[model samples]
Target: MKALISTGGQGPDFEKVKDIFTHVNLVVAADSGLNRLVEWGIEPDFLVGDGDSIDTENVATKKYSYNPAPRDKDFSDTELAIIKCLEKGADEIILIGGGEGRLDHTLSNVGMVKKYAQISLWMTSKEIITILSPGNFITHHLPQTQLSIFPLDDHSGPVKTRGLVWELEHIDLNQSMSLSNRCVDSEINWEITQGRFLLLATYE
Candidate 1:
């Protein structure tokens, strides 16, 4: 199943979330994320959080099911939402509102994608970010969108790409290298020979 997870950080544009809402099998909210959905006049299938950042009365009016967690816990509210999605057999998860907030929280949320590497996961704000495991991956984006690739660990070996302004042919990537490149074509094809990396695409 495909899951859409809204987190309690800086939310993405309403249009962006709405565009994919119809494609998801499930929608979940984490804490203040409920507030975001309420503002958008949309209700999620399930809500997961500690009930700390949301108005209890407002939530009571919503008919959606909720899973309250302890205020003090090992995981963040977003993580809890992810766990719920996974428990419900979600093979793919799209995380919204996970970026552009508390630096630590944003980092933690990004780390979650790495932890759940077995599943296809994405985090989006002004930019869409995903971890690319070793294999061929294809993506489509508008022309002129900025595309960047970075090694998640010490180094990634022999990365190859096409459809970008600066195409790569089996080139090594490391933390120090930031390919602030752009897509000349709508279709992007990439392959990683070894190791994993983060792929980011955003409007310039």
Candidate 2:
């Protein structure tokens, strides 16, 4: 089943998000993300975090509360939520509000998304972010929207992107480069040979 995790991030269309994610089988709140559920009058099935940023008692029950350590340096709240979902046999993950007002948190959340690379992870806000390995990827976009594929690590060889405005062929994309790519078509597809890449599909 698919899992939905809410994070305390800056999302302008928060009110409109619930409708987009109503198909999710289970809902989870990460730390202060519980406030987002409260704003919508919807209680999450589980709450995962350090329990410092949020009060566990405010939720429907403390039974599903997963309190880690305030000093634990292994995982972030978002990463913990992903592990919980994975343990419960989740095949896909959808994250909302992961790009909140804080730049550090937003960047950390993106890193967390990459850590859950074993599963099909998708982050949604005003835009959608996804990661793909060496495989055929397909996604739809609106007119003038941008789509960029950048290698997360140093490229071992070459990569190719098709159906985009500024297509790349066997290009070396490392962490030092590749960000804010613009989309040029209503549909996009790509193929890769070296390293895993992050796909940022935006509607701007």
Report every candidate's CA lDDT.
Answer: 0.79, 0.69
- Global CA lDDT computed for model 1: 0.79
RMSD for each of the candidates: 2.2, 3.1
Q: Tens digits of per-residue lDDT for model 1 on 48-70?
A: 99999987766888898876899
Looking at model 1, which ten-residue stretch has the lowest summed lDDT? 170-179
Candidate No. with top lDDT: 1
Candidate 1 TM-score, true structure as reference: 0.87
Model 2 Cα lDDT, one tens digit per residue, 1-204: 888888777543655466756777888888878777767777788888886677545654544555554757588888888888888888888777765377888778767766676445455555666667776666677767766665665553466666666677644576444556666777777766766776776645
